[model samples]
Target: MNTINVVIIDDEFIVSETLKSYIEEYTPNLNILSVINKPNDAKEIISKLKPDLIFLDIQMPILNGFELLKSFEEINFDIIFTTAYNNYAIEAFKVNAFDYLLKPINVNELQNTIHRYYLKKKNNPLFQYGQVKSLLEKINTPNKTERITVPEIGGLTILQTSEIICLKSDYGYTDIYCKNGSKITSSKALKHFCSLLKNHPDFYEIGKSGIINLNYISKYYNEGTIILENNIKVSVPRRSRKAFLETLQIQ
Candidate 1:
């Protein structure tokens, strides 16, 4: 197996060190070229070493991962972004077909991500710098509509917030129901989507495990039951029933 040179750029010392240890112990095919804590020095080091893959952190002082990439005229390396769950960043990565690992990194996910990268490299020699460029543009542009990236088999599915009828928590995963009569299972937890759509006007949390889109509501009963599009029913807990009814102006 050919060794893939790698560089890790994260501001947190512990995070970078933990990742380094995981890679060293688990993935023998990947060589750790450098673990850089300073985002400012990353450009010079990356330019000098020219590693095959980069493990980049999204939020950093002085220069962020996106800004660091923007400094490059032509990107020749693949990137796997590391970030604490940020809806916008995750959406951008998914939309652009880039790989990302959520922080407090899971060892199994790390190994799987690296394995997938190796497979992709073996099958397709072409690098996707255009996707990176597009991601940067998306970040810079103002979006009027809200959207979320649903992780599916093989790749990601981008759904407009309006298209979603409701979200149901199924243990560790979230089951998303769409207006188009399709269901998507996402690895993200219910709280993740709740946090993502918190500020949006149309989405309301029905209980601990469900969120329903206000626009999709077809009927609401005084007994704290909501009937949505496609005849889907969601129950509102007694504690939140008053607020839920007020939101619908049914009182």
Candidate 2:
């Protein structure tokens, strides 16, 4: 068994880490190289790391898995796409026989995918890369893109506007807190995202560092703070209080 180096790219931290753990624990000669969640960083990492296999997530924000593949002139390593949705399964397999793992990855399916790769590569040691455009073309395009594209460290996170509870700034980055209790730390500043989401009327700026979801407000406090549905308290600074209160009243 050759020591195969592996890199994983997924917007979800838990999903990417879980896949890393599963590969390391179950695969005989697999070496988990790196786990990245940002799509922009993936290209640089992939070029520098030079992993034998890459576990990629398909529906990342801004730049998707397919877009990433299209950027490369020639692919040197194998790619296995991980997708949460099932709509792309048949088309994914159709494109160059590349494999895809549905979210909540099944243990047996994972083993089979790895085994298939080992068998194919063991015999040839040279796997040809496939064209991503054909499959991408046939896929459904959203009539209106309702998801917010947030650029994070290793990849991009595509989240529903409703799912986001608030945006909190820390140092240079913005923390996107979700209703599901997931937080995405983005490379961009809070103001940048605040501007991008300006079209969405529900986002409210609390003071200088906080942006709260008006739809998820639990209660407003006398201290100019508001509690969110998930018990997260967002403070409204004195400067923004009058406008904030007015906005709340109108809503």
* Clashing residue pairs in candidate 1 (N, C-alpha, C atoms within 3 angstroms): none
Per-prediction TM-score: 0.56, 0.56
lDDT tens digits by residue: candidate 1, 1-251: 89999999987676788899999999999999999998989999999999999999865555667879999998988899987644776888788778888876789999999888878778876645667788889876222226555654444566878899999999988999999999999876787677557756788888888999999999988888889999999988889998887888852
What is the lDDT for 244 in model 2? 88
Off by over 4 Å in 2: 132-251
Weakest lDDT window of 10 consecutive positions for candidate 2: 139-148
Give, for candidate 1, the lowest lDDT window spanning 10 residues: 141-150
The lDDT of each candidate is 0.82, 0.77
List ranges where model 1 is wrong by over 4 Å: 141-251
> Could you report the Cα RMSD, in angstroms, for every candidate shown?
9.9, 7.4
The candidate scoring highest on lDDT is 1
